[model samples]
Target: MILAAGLGTRLLPLTKKIPKPLLPIIDKTLLQIAIETACKANPNIIVINASYLSGKITEFLGAHDFGVEIKVSVEPDILGTAGGIKAVEKWLSKDDFGVINSDIIATVDWDALKKIHKNSNATATLMLRDNPDPAIYGPLCLNEKGRVIRIVNTKNRDLSGAEPLLMFTGVSMLSPAIFERIPAGRAVEISSEIYSPMVKAGEPLYGYVTQAEWTDAGTMENYHKAVMARFATCKTSIGMTAKSLKYVTIRPPVHIDTGVYIRAGSTIGPNVAIHEGSVIGASVILKNCVVTPRSNVRSGAFLDGEVI
Candidate 1:
């Protein structure tokens, strides 16, 4: 299951037009990448929860067929992370299911994590990371044996080096039993209401850390970082139908979608994604930016680290 219903308030204006799930990562939307990644686990179906601007998500799913089956849990009132999953209890009760946050770009090994979950006999197993500075990222305090004992405060802690902490990677394995604890059709937070108390009650909540490339694209800085990393690896990909004038500098890692018109003398690249039907005027320089679909970029403008 993918939790994609969040309003993405931090990503304002950009998400003002498109939902977070549909945010582009490299050449694919975040929803597509997440679905493609989770499909590697060989699950029978993928369930996504959508709320903000759900029509676009519904339209995308209706038109495109991912290799695996997809079911959307639409929230008329914006059910939160826990509530959204709780509503899908019937679909997930058959077996333990893995949940992924749509805003994050990760390459987690689901098969390996499943084995660890089975071996540890945990009710909920979260994908963790041994980040150097767990202070900035919320910390998941774990015992030597890998059992998560508690969730630290929700702020950037300036703790000393002696206390080791692992950050929650927003991916977790949850058994059907978790549903019984959370009510359906109500907004509820996962960490505060579910995992924290479960850990205190000795319910075998474990943390499994791995060295996967994870980019939490919830904020602009991190989103920019994710774009730069992916562009460095896969480079730029321009749609064949995207029209661009001659002498325009097309830098690597920039993704220009179909129907985009780029005027002459404009430079774009190194972490930029211009969505379909957008018009980029002459002499414009865009770097580390995302131009939403059908948006018009002013002429001779320079936009850096922004979502136009």
Candidate 2:
């Protein structure tokens, strides 16, 4: 299940116009990237839960096919991570299911998590990453055996063997048993409300440590970072012919989509994504920012750390 119901309060104006999941990251929306990533796991079907602007979610899903059966679970009132999954219990309870947050970009090893959960008899297996300050992000402490013994300040089991705390990547593989812990028709967070109590009860919860690239695109700054991360392997990606871009100094890692017109003498890049139909005036300097579709950047304007 892909959790796309959050209000995206942190994203502000960007999200005010479009749902967080629908926010574009270069060529694809965040939701599309997440769904494609989930498809790598070879699941029989994909389920997405939407609330805020649920119509757009449904419309977007209908426009594409990710080679898997995709279904949208619309929530009249926002049901959080736990409740979202619980509401779709009937479809997911057939077997263990995977859940991913639409606001995050991650490369989780789903097969590894499935194996870990199956072999360890764990009720749920979470994808965790090594962070210097897990406490700041709410830690998920794991033992030497890779069992999650604590979440944030709550610990249900003894933690004498706890390893360095890790960060939750918001990607998990859960068994049907988790449904019993989540109440229906309500907002229930997975960490404090569900997992923490399960930990205290000795229910096996495991962690799959991964060294994959991940970024939470819930905030504008982080969203910019996520877009920049996608260009790490390639220098610059131009959606159209080079003849259309003349006298423009494009630094590496810059992405200029089709239909975007950049005037002469403009410098763009070192982490920039100018979407389709945007116009960049002459002598404009854009760095570390995103230019939304159909926008007009006035001449002589300089943009940094912004989304316009």
Candidate 3:
């Protein structure tokens, strides 16, 4: 299941027109990237929960046949993470199901996770990484035996930096038993509600630690950082610039896409991205900025850290 019902308040203006799940990451939306990552595990059906701008997500997923059955659960009222999953309690009656966040960009060894999950016969297996800067994300503490003992603080508010905590990657495989633990019609989070209570009850909750390529592109700063990291790793793509006029000069580390027409004698990049459908005029200098799709950067414009 793809948890994608957040309002994405951090990435305003950009998300004002589109939901964060649909935000572009190079050639694809964040949701598409997540789905691709989940495809590695290859489940029979993929369920996505949608609330904000459900129409666009519905249309986009419909247009692309991922060669697998896709089920989108539209939430009339934006239920929090746990409630959102509870909303689809009927569809997930099989063994265990994997859940991935729509805004998460990562590639983990799905086979390894499944092997451990099935071998351990755990009720829920959280994909955890070594906690980095405990302030940004709270810790998911585990016992010496790798059982998740507690999850303290949160990405949103983490002033108390706890120790011996691994970071939850917003990815997990859960048993159908979790549905029974949640109270019906109440919006709750997995960490505070389910995992915490499970630990108290001494349930078979475990953590699978791995070093995977992961990032949370849920905010502007993190989005920029994730894209920059993608550039460094050669995972980013530069789209076609107008070669007819040859008015383009792209500096190092930039990801531009289709419908971008660069006028003659314009210098772009050195940390810039001209998203699809953006027009760059002559003598425009774009550095450390993003020209969003459908935007027109006038002639002789200079921008940095500003999204057009």
Candidate 4:
């Protein structure tokens, strides 16, 4: 299940206009990336849980033709992480499935995770990564055998024999058994509600450690940083039969949506994307930003943050 139900309160004014998952990082929305990543796993069906601006999500997914069956679970009221799982209990009952946070962008090895889960006979297998600073995301302690012993605050330096801390990577393989552990009709966090209890009960919870890049774009700063990072690696290309003004300076790695009017002396890109119908003013400068459709950037303006 792709968890996209959270109200991204941290992303404030931007999220107030558009859902966090729908916000562009580079050129594509976070939801699109998550869906594409999950598609690589060859799952029979992909279930997405959406709450904030559910119509936009539904419409966006509907427009795309993903190979697998796509299903959406709309929550009338917001449900915490664990509650969202419970909300999709019926769909998950069909098989042991994968759960991922929609906002996290990572290159996960889904096949390897599935293999490890089956081999370990674990109720749940969590993807873990070594983190230098555990204070921000607490720490996951593991025994010598690599079994998760507990999650503890990094401030408690008094705790002895604690191995190097690892942070949860927001991706996991879970059996249907997890649903049995959570009570119905209550909002709960997956970490605090389910994982913590399972650890205390000595239930088997395996961890898959990898040094992959992961970014949680839940805040404006992180969002901006992530977009720039992604743009840096994107291949530069100019679409076939596209027109460009002689005086316009477009650096590499930019995507100009069709019908965009980039006027003379305007500089776009190095890391930028302008959606359709956006009129780039003369002498305007846009760097490391995204201008959504139908927006107007007046002349002599500098746009860095996402413009909608």
Candidate 5:
């Protein structure tokens, strides 16, 4: 299940018109990237749950065929993570399923995750990573044996012997047993509401640590981080094709989509992404920001660290 139903309150005005799932990450939307990631596991069908701006998500899904069968479950009211999955219980109850947050950019080894999940008697296997900072991003404690013993302060067992805290990557493979654990008919987060309690009960929840390329693009800073990281690694990335026009200076690591025309004397980038249909006027300067689709940056403007 691709969890796409959050209001994305952290992104605010950017998500006011475009839902978080449809937010562009260079050439593709977050949802598109997530589905492609899930396809690697070769599931029979993929399910996306959408609430805020459901029509747009629905429309976006219909525009592309990703080879694998895809279905959208529109929630009239925003169902929190666990609730959203519970809403689609019928479609997912037959087998173990993988769940990913649409706003994250992660290239988890699906085969490796599946291998460990299938080999264990775990109720759920979460993809965890070394916590960059436990103070900022809450910690998930894992034991030397790979069992997830605590989330934040919620502990399944005494944590005196636990290893260093790890971060949950918002990716997990779960048994059908999880459905029975989630309550029916309400909004609730899977972490605090379900997993924390399960951990306290000593449920067989495990962590599958990975050294994958991953980032949560749910905030502006991380969004910029994801874009910059992609620019640095992807040699044939969309940003590489942004050529400088006569008198226009385009710094490296700038992604300009199709149909965007920049006038002369414009300085774009170092860290920037201009989406489709945007017009960059003469003498405009843009850096460390994202241009939403079809935006028009007027002549003689200067913008930095602003999502326009």
Candidate 6:
């Protein structure tokens, strides 16, 4: 189950216009990344649980066709992590399944996670990563056998005895048995409601450690960083035939979509994404911003934040 329903209150103005999952990092949305990653696991069907502004999500899905069958579970009201899972219990009960958050960026090795869970006979296996300061996130303490023994302070300090008090990587594989532990109908956090109980019950909840890069792009600063990181990693440059006019400065790592017109003396990018049909006036400086489709930026303007 892919959780795509959060309100994303932190990313105010940006998310107000577009769902957080739909916000682009480079040219791809977080939802697309999550869907593609889950496709690698070869699940029979992919389920997305959506709340706030679900119409946009539904419209996006309808416009684009993904090869696999996609199912959406709409929530009348916002449901917490565990509640969302409990809501989808009927669909997931048939077999072991994976759960991921839409706002996270990670290359999850679903096959490896499945193998580890099956071999260890664990009810659930959480993907974990080592964080230098676990205080920011709740830390998971594991015993010698790799079973989660305790959840340290919510801040995740006191890591002396814990070899590596890892943070949850926002990815996990769970057997249908997990539903038996979670109560039906109500809001519940996975960490506090489900994980804590399983650990206290001595039920095996294994941690699969990985060094993969992961980021929670839920805040503006983090979201901006994620966009820059993706741009750095992208090998394909934007194909643009439009000549830069006299005295116009063109910086590296900018993606100027087709049919975009830039007037004389315009400074575009060090980091910028200009969508199709955007017209930039002379002497305008656009940096680290995104000009939405067909928008017009007049002359002598300095646009830093995104242009919507």
Error of 1 at 285 (Å): 2.7
Query: Model 3 over residues 1-308: C-alpha lDDT tens digits?
Result: 99999888989878888888988765567899889988898898889999999998999998998988899889888888899999998889667899999888888788878877778788889999987867777677778777887777464554344466679899998888888888778677888888888888999899999888889899888887766566655543576834543657778778787777888888887777778788888888887776667789899888876666
Off by over 4 Å in 3: 153-162, 232-244, 252-254, 304-307
Candidate maximizing lDDT: 2
Please, what is the TM-score per model?
A: 0.91, 0.89, 0.89, 0.89, 0.89, 0.88
Q: Looking at candidate 3, what is the lDDT of residue 205? A: 92
In candidate 1, which residue ranges exceed 4 Å CA deviation? Answer: 132-135, 155-162, 240-244
lDDT (Cα, tens digit) per residue for candidate 5, span 1-308? 89999898998877888999888877778999999999988899999999999999999989999998888899999879999999999899999999999999998898888777888778899999998876566688877677888787544333454458688999999999998889888888888998988889998899899888899999988876776676666442343233546677878677777778889888988778888888999999998878988888999999987777
Query: Each model's C-alpha lDDT?
Result: 0.83, 0.86, 0.82, 0.82, 0.85, 0.82
Please give the lDDT score for candidate 2: 0.86
Of candidates 3 and 1, the better by lDDT: 1
lDDT of 4 by residue, 9-87 (tens): 9887767767888987656889998988888788988999999999999999999998888899998887788898988
lDDT of 6 by residue, 1-308 (tens): 89999998988776776788897776788899888888889988888988899999988888877798888888879778888888888788999999999998998888899998898888889998886667666788777777888777674457677666788878999999988878777777888888988888998899888988888888777777777678777643454664554467878778777777888888987778877777889899988877655778999999886544
Which pairs clash inside model 3?
A: 239-256, 247-263, 247-264
Give candidate 5 misplaced runs (Cα > 4 Å): 154-163, 233-247, 251-253, 304-306
Question: Tell me, what's the RMSD of every candidate?
Answer: 2.4, 3.0, 2.7, 2.7, 3.2, 3.0
Top model by TM-score, which number? 1
lDDT of 6 at 155: 49
Weakest lDDT window of 10 consecutive positions for candidate 2: 154-163
Error of 2 at 211 (Å): 2.3
